[model samples]
Target: MQISQQDVHQALERGEFVPHFQPIIRLRTGQLYGFEMLARWAHPELGLIFPGDFIEQAERDGWISELTYQLLRKGLKEIAPLPGEPTLSVNISPPQLHGTSFVDQVHEAAAEANFPLNRLILEITESALAEDIVSVSKTVQSLKIAGCRLALDDFGTGYSSLLHLQSLPFDELKVDRSFVSSMTQKHDSRQIVAAVVGLGQSLSLTTVAEGVETEEQAEILLWLGCELGQGWLYGKPVPAEQLDEMMKRRQPHASNAILNGMTGRQSATALEIPPMQRFAQLRAIYDGAPVGLAFLDREMRYLSINRRLAAINGSPMEEHLGRTVAEMIPEFFPTVRPLIERALAGEVVAGVELTKPTQNPKELRTILLSYEPAFDESGEVIGVSVVLLDITPIKRAEEAQRESEAHFRHMIELIPQIPWIIDPEGRALDVSQRWLELTGVNDDQWRGFAWLDSLHPDDRQPTIDAMHRSFQSGEPIDIYYRVRRSKDHPWQLLRSRGSARRDDNGEIMCWYGSLEIIGESDAGKK
Candidate 1:
């Protein structure tokens, strides 16, 4: 039998949504790490309805947030009280990250369930992260700040780049199941899996190999350095009741069984944590690349260098040690000499700005350069330890975001109808100049609930009621309200329509609306 959208809607109203837990395993020890909670509909007539059928439709119908919240609540209910405080990974939708009050709703949901935020892992897709990364990144950062971890799902499936990984924070990297299922049969897929694992190791991200259906795939992934695996080989997704029993029966594979569900935030912000403590793992994986590391003698001659720094400086690692910094790159030596001098003088210099050569010579790479004075056992200065993390993409992303915001504001101003924005609570956030010009009020006078005072006496109460109804129902507001052009002028009929901007949890974060004079060609012209 075919299922209609209405069937799905009714299922949600009757509280039919439930969480199905899939096992994620720690590869090295064959121990269970955590479960990824997937959403399912327990239809009275149709049995468990999977998300692939209804999730997109829900989002299209503007009710995905409701679905997300219900699943989150049900999932939290199932696991929050379990022993060992097992980590739970939940997939977050794109719309929730883009405009919905996802950040606030998540914190609220976890708090309501008395769940620990650190044990929560939010899995985001690469495609979603690529869409409007600037806005999504801010929302993601807020989640990170709240102690929630993030995982980048479907590692090689979308248009993700090394830059995307560096700019947006992620705690775990999942090699998409397609690669794992095909790795043994396809050479390219195996190489991709190996590369992703290396990327994860370099960035201190816990790599989880997905869709490992066979022992051979698991062994190959483990050999490729992936620490986690999730698929039928471990166990298929089951109801929470079964999961609870499994959790109780299973002991940690090793005394130090890897809890790979969550890891620390991996981003430039990680730099704020003590350099040595933060970079210790990074230094150990010096061969993995991403960051450039090197050591120079007191005379500024290269003593040791990693392959990445050698490639970056357009020189071989062996040649780097024999040649002095000036001899290797005379162009950059002048700018770096001062910072090097400071390190040699026993001063630890950090965040020293430096430029690097990119493929496009016109566009130089931005480097967050740090230099620390290396010391001997006797406390005498030996050399300078250098760490160069390229941040050019991050800088370029910021510039692009600024330009996009300017364009958005310009577009908002150009529309004929008067545009305005409001907080979820109905307080004015922005009232376009057009509204002010027509009303003969300054921007300050037009903002906040004070604008309600200018409504025609008879329309004020009705307008307030309409706003409340819309805010309460998460529906669009549309009404013919009357407002005076001036205190002395007669009331003019206006058509206003606004809708709630919801986060993934069905919580309103803000409202966007526009106003038009009923008879006038343009609100501003009138």
Candidate 2:
């Protein structure tokens, strides 16, 4: 049945469109990780209506944006008070995401609510990937910069899902309910789920299974190495109040079990064991930890060093034992002494990035050093625990990113013409120095769609429409527009032309354009 615009608008006015949150659980220990906010209409006569029943009509009637904004505000308000750092995932349609005001709206909502942007996850359907990917990628990058995570919802359901996964910066990949619901009974579904989990693992993304309604399905997902899950087995989408109750009822042990599993340990059991046995277990866990670990005495001599720490220092465990950091790394002793003294004074210092010279003087490694004071039963500082993490790759990546940005800025500044780069969403990511100077606008004013503010009011809409057309069609854009140089100066007619920059796979990455003064064209006279 078709829903009228009046009905939808009335529902909005009545505040009937609300968020129903479904629990997303950790598959390993069945702990509640977060909730995916699903939209539902609390209809007066027709009873509760799901998005499937009216979302298309809402979109057709131009009410989808309002609906999404309402849901976002409602979801954030509802989830803000929840305990245990639960994230709220809200679904975003392509049209809403592509709008110029979308990011601003999100930022405003988050700021108004004082919500932690990192705990908010915006989920986009895989089908949305079929839209102008360049715009989507840019929007994704902006969202990430704002500290909100993105998820590819219903992943593997669309034809270009893989491309979306590869091109976008999605932090999570949600396996489609179709695959999760049937994986237990269907061999093909099982294979698809396994493949998706494997792909997520390879990409270092969190994998979530949807529509897991049975223990068997959940078990299969766990066995397949899926990290998270959501379905009826966990709970149906419930109202905020009910969700609060459910959260209260959730067992703390479940979270503990999940954390232990994450640390490669089974559910911890209470046992009456000798102190020596307990010490051995702790030593084993510490030695096997992924990071380099070492224990030093009050005098800053190495009492024990794990193999990982030894390797990071370019030495063996035996050589590190009973030796001061100066003896092991004399070159770095000057830098290490202060941190050791601070740690010995019961101050825990961490995340100190420093250069560590290896045996090969030509090769210097960047490492992050952290020191924690160890205490005895009498509450006296006995020693310091040192952790060394090799960060050479991270440092190199940062340096490369800096160089790329510098080079891009240099090229743009050298160009005489007013040049700009826009993402598929028509948001300006880069504007040349000439363009900024011509408009007398600062960097902040020239970013995103703010460049439109410098355009003649009469020409802004047409230019935007033309850019949208070019983005959708992946064609070159050639448009003439009047831009304001200053308050005293008249609008200057300028012609701008740009084309899509595509990757090897023919996907649009960005649009580059340059503007030139048109010098009183016949059309400008009009």
Candidate 3:
């Protein structure tokens, strides 16, 4: 049963409604970066009810704005005692934001708490402002004018264009957690997140990704160039008291000091090597290594460069060292900036292909680059180590193969009938360009599974079984099948042949097969 507005009010009077704090972290740095305040209701009989259960109900009863105000006051009261006073992000309902006196209430709340308005982060969803943006824009602007932080929450999953985003005047962008969680596994999600992050960076806005739960997700986000992030992987929501306790337990043991040109946090007087010797050793390994290597400060400037990497930059090692990547390779700046920024924020980037400028005037070399955080032994990341491996030959070979395939495609396009190719596994390996052109199907989307879409249900299994045998036994096999082209068109008959190819080890590697159109009009009518 839903509680009444009066009942909710009574509960609030008795100090039942409160805020729960969830920690957000910078992926590269393990420090407590920020906190998102979640609303919670501690019921006497029901134990505890999360916002998911009661927040909308309160809104229906027209008491959510009042509840939110009370929670904000409670949140600030708890945050004030913290040592560093980390940024506090709170979710704001669109109704509340658009309500009259909303700006006044927020200002009065901050003034009463004597809190820094800049540290208060207000988050709002795109859906909430979908109805009327004019009023919403004014409301948000007024908040920002009052010296409060503004964030466009739940970015993506909306039709709102860049025009809406620009009009919001948001200072931070909280990428929808769905995109952040799925980015590592899906290309579409990765592209979407990358685009959003790019938009944020171009506007000089801080981008925070939510729902980061694993190291892989964190690594991908870092590689994609996101800055601040929050998720269960960092820390789940907790009470203010619990947050304080957790901080105390995890705080560093020492304040960290610098001694003899090295950041010193370890004990003095044992197995000490000269700083110059250490630097020299690092530089020596870097110079002689077959793989390219370089050092970068937090801002992604080349702190040191080795001969191999310098060759990739088309300059002397000394000349390229100490330069920003944007300066050395301006063309790659847009694509690589996020990575450098993520590394600067304390995240490792591995297995990313970076196109580098080479000494050959017109050539570009693709290299696999990995960047790891570098510390001065004080556990604070001061710079990064970059390793680059040339993969130009591999890339060139792949391109040549693609070009040859394109030529074969052109040849197939000239044929009168649809043609197709399949591997031994009965999966579509390739299809004639004419078949795709006539069917209005994308050639790139013609993956193994898609070929099934073209076959008659009755003939599909038989065709597949025969192809499997041909591949497994290294024999030439032929079969007849009826293929469905379109719902309005009759099933067309076809003759398919399969031939197997084996590697030097005599293990079957692939099946080369073709489907040739055959009908009553054709002589090969079998």
Ranking by TM-score: 3, 2, 1
How many pairs of residues collide in model 3?
A: 1
Ranking by lDDT: 2, 1, 3
Better of 2 and 3 by lDDT: 2
lDDT of 3 by residue, 43-69 (tens): 888887898888888877778878888
Off by over 4 Å in 3: 251-526
- Regions more than 4 Å wrong, model 1: 1-5, 251-526
Please provide the root mean square deviation of candidate 2 (C-alpha atoms, Å): 33.0
Tens-digit lDDT track of model 2 for 33-72: 8999988999999998888998887767778888888888
In terms of lDDT, the best-performing candidate is 2
Q: How many residue pairs clash in each candidate?
A: 3, 3, 1
Residue pairs with clashing backbones, model 2: 134-424, 135-424, 135-425
Q: 1 or 3, which is superior by lDDT?
A: 1
lDDT of 1 by residue, 327-413 (tens): 998999999999999999899999987777788878888888899999642245779999988788898999999999889878878
For each candidate in the order shown, give its overall lDDT on alpha carbons. 0.80, 0.82, 0.75
Find the 10 residues in a row with the least total lDDT in model 2. 264-273
Pick the winner on lDDT between candidates 1 and 2: 2
